[model samples]
Target: MNAHQSLSRRRMLGLAALGAAALAGQSTITAAPRAAAAPAAGVSDGTFVPAVVVGTGYGAAVSALRLGEAGVSTLMLEMGRLWNQPGPDGDVFCGMLQPDKRSSWFKTRTEAPLGSFLWLDVANRDIEPYAGVLDRVNFDQMSVYVGRGVGGGSLVNGGMAVTPRRSYFEEVLPQVDADEMYSTYFPRANSGLRVKNIDRGWFEQTEWYTYARVGREQAAKAGVGTTFVPNVYDWDYMRREADGTVPRSALTAEVIYGNNHGKVSLDKSYLAAALGTGNVVIETLHQVKTIRQRSDGTYLLTVEQKDDGGKLLATKEISCRHLFLGAGSLGSTELLLRARETGTLANLNSEIGGGWGPNGNVMTARANHVWNPTGARQSSIPALGIDDWDNPDHPVFAEIAPMPAGLETWVSLYLAITKNPERGTFVYDAAKDRADLRWTREQNAPAVAAAKSLFDRINKANTTMYRYDLFGKRLKAFADDFCYHPLGGCVLGRATDNYGRVTGYKNLYVTDGSLIPGSIGVNPFVTITALAERNVERIIREDVKDSHRD
Candidate 1:
């Protein structure tokens, strides 16, 4: 069968089986037993109190693992349901990989208030007067993708694992010791996420190869060399694809929405292992509304519990000696910004919400020769990257990679590193009880121009195999506004100190993408994970130990 025919047949069968399973009220796959909680280790019974880590995304999961490993008791509060759970729509809700686009899964999730690209057209039910909330910001100009589940953005990310360019890291994060940080933390982060290269065979057999080949040809024509790189996915499933045991439909490129067979999100990786430690307790469906500081320096958090209908059923108050904010750049920044503006933690410096940028995550597709059969482009991503754009003279950072195609013959994604824009502010709408994020177009103009220029160069150089018509038109019309990577509102220097500590609030820290000052020019996950690793280690070795040692 042709590729399209095979894909269609598999999709039909899978959907039919899913329907049957639902009707029978049974799952084809059985879930493992929940892990039991273990006793706290390191601290005295009375002295070692359980801390609550709010938000179950990247930062939260990483913090939970680190704290749990240190024997510190922690309760992880996730506003979203587990990605592994069945949603109200009777479909599995894996953030970026959700098979059904119309699923009402976000309605029941606490983090649903945080918007996403998949539901951009659907109103946010959690926000009252939904029209105002939806219309308040620039959705057309920028595509914002956020995760509202147990794994958060990890559930929706492309699963490409990339370390930031060395110069970008050294220049942006001077406070971080690059050599030690990379050596100690990068490996640990990659291992935890099970990062590895996509199998060469899978690339050769998959349609994704066609897409990547086109991307490479286009890059080469522009005098830019493209290379394959590793991704964070289960190799076993990939092998199954090679054998055709699992149909190619199983490896379909429907990633950013959620991947069914590919991608190792936090729920399956770090969070799962942390649960195994039995020292981590996760509370799903708990949305943190406010965080207050008590007289004794402890944190008093008010959280609301929401049901599947997206209605608040109960409000609960919890106290913890320490609080870790891992709500991504947008989520964390909004929370901290609201607290500061409302005088809850007004002593924060001028830096709060001072540095914000989208990591220049512009998404554009390049067309390649139709005859070049980029095999199985769905299962594997463009593994190699071109670093020629790193030159200061060029003033741009761009990585050319293969994109999974549907109807298109072959296409690749070029993520460019443009100049960082001025920090944007996250204003809290008291009426809506949520954040209203706004950014000016002028802030990213230079980066946008630089990105277009880079693509134009690539297109001109590859007249034989590739073309850059879309990028050229986008540059001339200035209409390309959506970025896969959205970063920085409560940036590292402003919202927190050099060490990721909130300036005015004691025992409170901000990690994750929020700590990234501006754009890193490549996929930001590895950098975020590595930084979190470094910060958490420091917190354990310095702050936590010093408190006990003294």
Candidate 2:
């Protein structure tokens, strides 16, 4: 047999042994467990699976793991390639300090949402073609920043795993079983994601957290409550890095590009456990282009395989009895929108691309006094946030972000999550064969106004001013054109049923951040994961229970 076949056989034998050992009440097994089907490099010809999950983010990871635990085999498809392997520089990922071609997708120039430094071109660079980790999908009025690799946003985010308040969650998804979500799925998702808070003792004294402390003090002066945000980053490792006992990740300015260490991304948690179940497989570098249903109720997907240079190597078709859409807000919406417009799935409801929002994202900077140094050593992992969501007029939950330039810039950056009621729609552009986000520049005004209302109070109380040098062209405060937390697009109860069952479709579901109606008032990954956990449990119990009966 060939090496691939031999490896697969060995993996199956090892899994069989592990199962036997478990049944016999043994403590452990000898062989390291592997995924049910080995992770494929690309989409092979004539591939078929019992189930397929598109994208490997929080929603996809949770569904894959839960389905695997239920003894259902699944194949995950990711647009970007795997990032766990080291490159020629002996590092798995490029750092934000000097981002190379690996920082973006096929673009010749990097397009960081924070595009300019002091309104100059010092932040971006031109590079050759490569499959980068972060992708900035641009629209006419807004740009959405999303992670592209196997771990999705987890690969590029600040590891801020936050759950929205109960009232806010209920407001966004009222039909959802909030009781089950709070009592069961929320806690289950948190434990599964390995979310933790930073050490209070270390956060107070560490030089790395001085930026956070500066914001905390100013927020306190403004009489706003500051709360410690939980994250997926390992706080123990961060403490060791502070003491010089371990290698540094957050201290080394590793946030946007990718963390080399100290961050526990989805690849290390849910995705990892999913693979250990021996019933889940992931196919990287495979982008699903279209999805259509067969007459027999199976789903047919057309996927394209691409090389690092953005060359399309091949196109292949895969069929699955069940399909899960975990591609984030934009991706999942675009796919269904295109399919609906092209008559591939004409029965799809018109709400397929409606109810999109930017999660009320607004980034701003506050200039601290010269006497108040915000510290040169700033931790990329943010732990403190100014929680003013209870304010009836201007509700905002602003996280004190880090500006880890390795020098004291005397600026405090904050990414405020507001409660903007505006929603956008994705319209199919037949000329471009893609969906366009209908969010206009004017719609973002309310978001910026809300964010400014909260930050202005803190700035005025602390004798601070809005920093003009951070954003483009001496802008005083609030960059409202881009978002890191893109939510909605395929809203629950509209595009799909309350349980994420896409209208007029069987054995197909939407299990991602796209299910949220518009605003959630916090970092959305935790809510997305919890909602997926709740939906998948019902799906398995009601939809796929009989098929999995072996």
Candidate 1 lDDT (Cα, 0 to 1)? 0.60
Question: Model 1, which residues run further than 4 Å from truth?
Answer: 1-49, 86-143, 201-206, 247-250, 369-377, 380-382, 395-405, 409-413, 464-479, 546-550
What lDDT does the true structure give each of the candidates?
Answer: 0.60, 0.84
What tens digits encode model 2's per-residue C-alpha lDDT throughout 474-547?
66577988999888888989989888889999988999999998789999999999999998998988998857
lDDT of 1 by residue, 164-213 (tens): 76777888788788898678888878877778886677665554455555
TM-score, per-candidate, Cα-based = 0.79, 0.92
- Maximum-lDDT candidate: 2
Error of 1 at 214 (Å): 1.9
Clashes of 1: 26
Error of 1 at 382 (Å): 4.4
